[model samples]
Target chain A: MTDTILSHDDLTARVSRIFQRAGLSPLQSDAVARTIAAGERDACKSHGIYRIDGCLRTIKAGMVTLDAVPELAPEDGAIVRVAAHGGFSNAAFELGAPELARRAKELGMAALVINDCTHFAALWPEIEALTAHDLAAMAMCPSYSSVAPTGGNEALMGTNPFAFGWPRENTDPYVFDFATSVAARGEIELHRRAGTPLPEGWAVDADGNPTSDPEAALNGAMLPFGGHKGSAIATMIELLAGVMIGDLNSREALDRLGNFTLLPAHGELILAFDPARFSAGREGNAMARAETLFDAITGQGARLPSQRRFAARKRAMAHGITLSAEEIAHLDRLEERGLDAVA
Target chain B: MTDTILSHDDLTARVSRIFQRAGLSPLQSDAVARTIAAGERDACKSHGIYRIDGCLRTIKAGMVTLDAVPELAPEDGAIVRVAAHGGFSNAAFELGAPELARRAKELGMAALVINDCTHFAALWPEIEALTAHDLAAMAMCPSYSSVAPTGGNEALMGTNPFAFGWPRENTDPYVFDFATSVAARGEIELHRRAGTPLPEGWAVDADGNPTSDPEAALNGAMLPFGGHKGSAIATMIELLAGVMIGDLNSREALDRLGNFTLLPAHGELILAFDPARFSAGREGNAMARAETLFDAITGQGARLPSQRRFAARKRAMAHGITLSAEEIAHLDRLEERGLDAVA
Candidate 1:
């Protein structure tokens, strides 16, 4: 069942060709391909090539414009709003991250709200770019709603993932990314498709009753991770990601044929704050202080967060990225169909 | 046997006298008394008179300076550091919140870090004060080591608490405050003293075995809520509240004399940001927008976080702050003991 390894460059080239054949402009195609490849290289398979099929389906459905690009809108202070014009999230993020970080370095902090961008893959890359600029960054995205409020039956909220990155001295940046749900919707979906039972407390049946049946859980709603506290954090994120950005909620977005056309696309809120701005020319010393504290905590043998994935990325890059047999077959099919359409 | 109820005024007067007798200046004693009473009024009994005995013990142990006051040191870009000189947190916060808010309004955001302060009762009052000035505020406090890191047997992290407040248009500001632990240390202590069992998964015994025995749980370590995710968030908060503020880590502080002076001291980080600073000068409309969003979310029937406590405070104030019979007896004991010898 295991698949053959694909060199990173080889995979990226193939993905780029597939996007170009699907009618994306070269720049947009390369951005999307690079993003997916980054996810694969970083071991985020769920957001990597696994999403290519969905993106193709959405493009065929005329929900996303293969060649669309976002343009900036007028904003006050360090806030910038981008009109995605139905573009892909990868392209939008490729454009937004550096812009936001640049402004943040000048203004201390900058907030960029991307409106109407289609599904973007892993969020870590965007945060990584900000951290590379020596800025602390936080990003949130409101996807299609699948989670229910604690004690409620209906799916009134999205899994609403949040990611944060902080720079450290002589160490990998501290990066943390997680969905506010008890378990990711993808995990539940995978279990359901495989006809397996879910762990208790991860989800409930459509009637709001706790159920181990993966099918029932998928058809119902996911629970917040830690009862009220998790629910509260999710709620706040929803406000920041959906309401503040003026995007449609999951239910509303789904009602619009699963295409988000709301003003200020429903994708991500990226914020960056330059530590140098706050450190008053002592950036090096401040970073060292952060590293010393981190070492002190982990010196006792506890692993730091995200360190494993970082190590995985380094190891995979050194060796090669592996793909499941099914994933490889899926990509081959996509390549053939895309070539046929272009021919 | 339950003790008699004491009037709010009577309890305040007694606490004030005790603090004064302990060598706190009159103004300092009054500030401490008011903070404790505010906690009682808000029904945070564990942080109110419940801590009076501990405060007395710590004072008698000569670990705190009754007459000490905070000395402020301003940093670049709206950051301020307060050297507490080992003073009570109540007094320190009373002197710090206003200064922090003023500077934040001036600079769009301000961060105040207080080191070497005594334990403050409750965080809600400080959040409320900031929200009243139309500022969104967040506070973090890292206390003594009481919780274990995820998968660790030894207690190495504090229950480090975080509180956030957001201002709405017409309705009261929304506030959230919670300890990072599954339950606060005080709750575990109370359960142990009462010979009660804890809820399952709330804590682990000394050997890192999950246990329901409160005594074992206390001797062991409290679990983070929601497993690894909660633990991760707690770890992040510790970095922000401890490392970023240049304060002590819980374990390091404890090692000093069971005093754990890892950082310069146990520290609290207070951040305030004015919404008006970002809303592009349309003050009234921005407020309206925030309120509309709050109403929309609450209208969905999910209870807003911290709304109940706020309602309780209103009711308590209307009918006069209530004291349990036992609390009344404790106040009487304090009055009879006289402040000097108690200290």
Candidate 2:
């Protein structure tokens, strides 16, 4: 059968309905639906409609607060905070972003700290939100522990993701969001399912010896990207986003969840910098200067990160987001069954 | 001949005398000397007395301002600005760090922007300055263009150094500073001198084809660490520390200097975060929490980033820094002839 195509709004609405029916508060459902839909719109299928099942499972397990209403903290100096109140991070971020942008403009820079949230979305969406306000932005958070620190034999740090964006004048903003792990745990699971050997340096066995066997890797630990440097960055995220925010670090999150099946409850750190304020009285326009740097990258035939996603987004907005027959049926079932559809 | 040993203070005084004889202002000389001495004390010899001749060479080339006294800009929100007036960045950072710490404590987070400075020192020195104030810190600066973006053939980004530190209660703060490039240009040069092949992925030849020949790699472009992730971060540095701060980017710095011999004139971005303020109203002590994470790392036999450097420092503080006779002779010549000591 031919795939079913839907506009971005249609997908968002459908996803929102699914969550609303699953007993999520309207505030959480709407924000989360936009994030999930954006993932599909950008052809990032792993984070797209695919994540709905995970959300539902978490809700079914009573791991997430179904009626949470994320609240913004009183304006603090250079820090705009949102207490997620045991909900998804999306609504919390949405609640805090405008204030973050405003304070970044007023203070030259400001941080948005989201606490006590079940975080599962990629960071680019949050980064893009701030970049849309014509600001450079950075965000990071720790996932449940899956990756080993470099030189260590066991998993300790999360597959923490770090993301950054710089606003552009007319084109899409420059952006990159990536896991600090050399490869994601999902990728290893995929390899195991396919009965393929894992890549060297991707993992170490249960006893910490280097291994290419997928099964051994699964029983062991994933490695950080770029060896020690990436490990250090992952550790930094745990400190800044987890420990500094007075929330769960990767180990704590994993322990609380008992397994990686559920979305990890953690905190997130996002910083916004108003380019205009930062570049005040400086020689050249910051936005224009950024364009030159982009040109140099593309001129040398190098692709910028997230170009493919942006390209997919452009096409999806123009044509539509297409879902396969199975996916469409899955969405239908989710809409009809709500929490029951998950298990 | 036996190696010469000198206390840290004596070494600093000696280095200061050399810079003074070469006509640097006392303000610039003292700060720069302390940085160099610290490098030696840490056994990070690459940035130690070896850097003196390079400083002299840059001075002889008339690239650095001989007597420029860095001036602090009036307090502006979360940004602490210091105009280095084309002097080396060491004095500028020293002039601005206390204010950066004060602002960070006041605002929870703040940034120090150093502009129009010839930056050659390792960023950890600046990171440590903030950590000394019991604040988590991050610092980045663009060097002259020498490293390529991941997919690009030509060098479009600098071997930009990224450094981070977290404060600890009774020990050295957790610190990690590294170039975003897979390797430093000096490493390739050393390989060339020793007639050794460059490591795979270290660089691409002039035609953008991967090469192992050190000479070809030297003439070509060094790759960024962790491929695209590292490239994106290096680019972020160019944008945030360079364009956003209204200072020379890597390419611009290279173009202005006309060669790589002199230190690149640009800006540095240092962010300071007051953990106490950030974790206020939260459950745990941020500093104590950081120690637990560090303990996990050590418990697993994964060394924290700066342990070796800290160990060297302890030894140097106890027994003084030992310099080979050849290094001692070089210092003597530099002191006697000042800028005339170099070609």
Candidate 3:
């Protein structure tokens, strides 16, 4: 059940070719391809090339327009709205991040809300773009229904993922990204594929009982991270990402299965602020101080959030990404078909 | 061990007189008193008038200056860094909230960081103040160490409470305030005083073993809400309130606990934003939309966050606050001692 990794260049080329065959303009295809490649580079495998099949499915369904560009509404001074008009979330973010970063630099802090975009992959790329530009950034998305309210048996909340990045003086920006649930549904999917048991307190069976069986958990509801507190935090995020953006909640979108044509209308909110505006040399100092305190508390034993992903990415970059035989076979099939479409 | 509640006016006047007798200026005393009374009005008993004795203790120890006013440091766009110089948090927020709210009106957002203030009672009033001005507000405070990090036995983090408020069209502003821990230390104290057992999983004994005894829990560590997820959220707030503001984390401040001459360098961060800048009628619409979705979910037998506090505040406002006989005796003793000090 192990997944195979593809070479970064090979993956990027295939992604670009797939988008081009789907009728995407050259620039649009390049942007989408780079976004997917960046996900692989960051080791966000769930959101990387794994999503290519889904994106292709969406394009074939006519749910996403390969040539459509986001429409910016009239706004002023540190705020912007993008009506994605059934475009790819990756495409919308690629088009919006730089402009949002530029506006934040000019205005001190800026917020961008994107609506009607189809599936978005990993959120870290947008945060990375902002952090690279020396800005502190945060982004949130209301995902499809999967998690349950704190005490309830039924699934009524999306995983509701959030990502925040802070600029560091010498090192990579401190980035934190997580779902409100105890574990993401993708992890559950991984466990199911591997025939592994789910962890206790992570999910409940359909009859509202906790279970260690991955299949039962998958057919049931995922638990929020920290009981009622996590529930409250998830609720706050939902209000911020769904209600504030005038989109549908997870419960309302439960009927939308894997079909991209029935994708739920969730919203994304992004905020970027310049650390220099608030503190002169404080950004770096703050990160150093944080690292010191974190180390003290962790004391050679603490694991900072996202440390593993970054480490994996570093290793993979040094030695090209390795793919298993099965994964390579799958990619070869896709490549053959892609070439046929191009012909 | 029951507590008493006084009429809002009576408590405000008595608290004001106590501050004046402690050498506070009349205006500052009134402002501080009102802030404290607001906590009682909102049923945050631990952070309400219960802290008057502690405030007096700090003042008598010469740790808090009765008449110190904060001065703004040079900065850009609606951010004020207040050098508290050992002032009370209530006083700092009373002075900073209005100023920040006024600036947010002009700039669409503003923040205030208070550096060296003494303990501030409930954060609701300050958040409510911004909502009163038709702005969204958030407040956070990093206190001295009191709770253990998730999976750790040491108390390495503060309860690190946060509060947020949003102004609605036809209803009271929706306010959400809670400590990040599984249960606040105050709840443990309440249970200990009442000789009651705590619920399981709420706390741990000194050895990090789960304990249901309130006294043992008090001597041990309170659990972070939602395991690692709650831990991550608390860590983020600690960075925001502590490192970002140039202050010490709770674990760092433990050494100076009984040093009367030194002020605890915990920090507070307050942010105010005007939703109108993002969308026309967004202020009211945001709140209304949140209420609608919240009602829809909760109507089918789900409870909303802070509903109990909202109900309690309403009941107390309508039927008048009642104090228990023991609480009245304590209040009388406090007043008598204050009169003796003045004499």
Provide fnat values for all models in the order shown.
Answer: 0.12, 0.87, 0.20
> Against the native chain B, what TM-score does each candidate's chain B reach?
0.89, 0.99, 0.85
What's the residue-level lDDT of A129 in candidate 3? 82
Individual DockQ of the candidates?
0.26, 0.90, 0.35
Give the per-residue lDDT of model 3 (tens digit) for A78-127.
Answer: 56677777676666776777788877776567777787777556677788
| Candidate 3 clashing pairs, residues 3+ apart or interchain | A226-B226, B4-B323
* Proportion of true inter-chain contacts also present in candidate 2: 0.87
Candidate number achieving the greatest TM-score relative to the actual structure: 2
Name the runs in model 2 displaced over 4 angstroms: none
Best by DockQ: 2
Model 2 TM-score (2 dp): 0.99
Models sorted by DockQ, best on top: 2, 3, 1
DockQ metric, candidate 3: 0.35
In candidate 3 chain A, what residue range of length 10 has the lowest lDDT sum? A254-263
**Candidate with the larger DockQ of 2 and 3:** 2
Docking level of model 3: acceptable
Q: Where does candidate 1 chain A have its weakest 10-residue lDDT segment?
A: A258-267
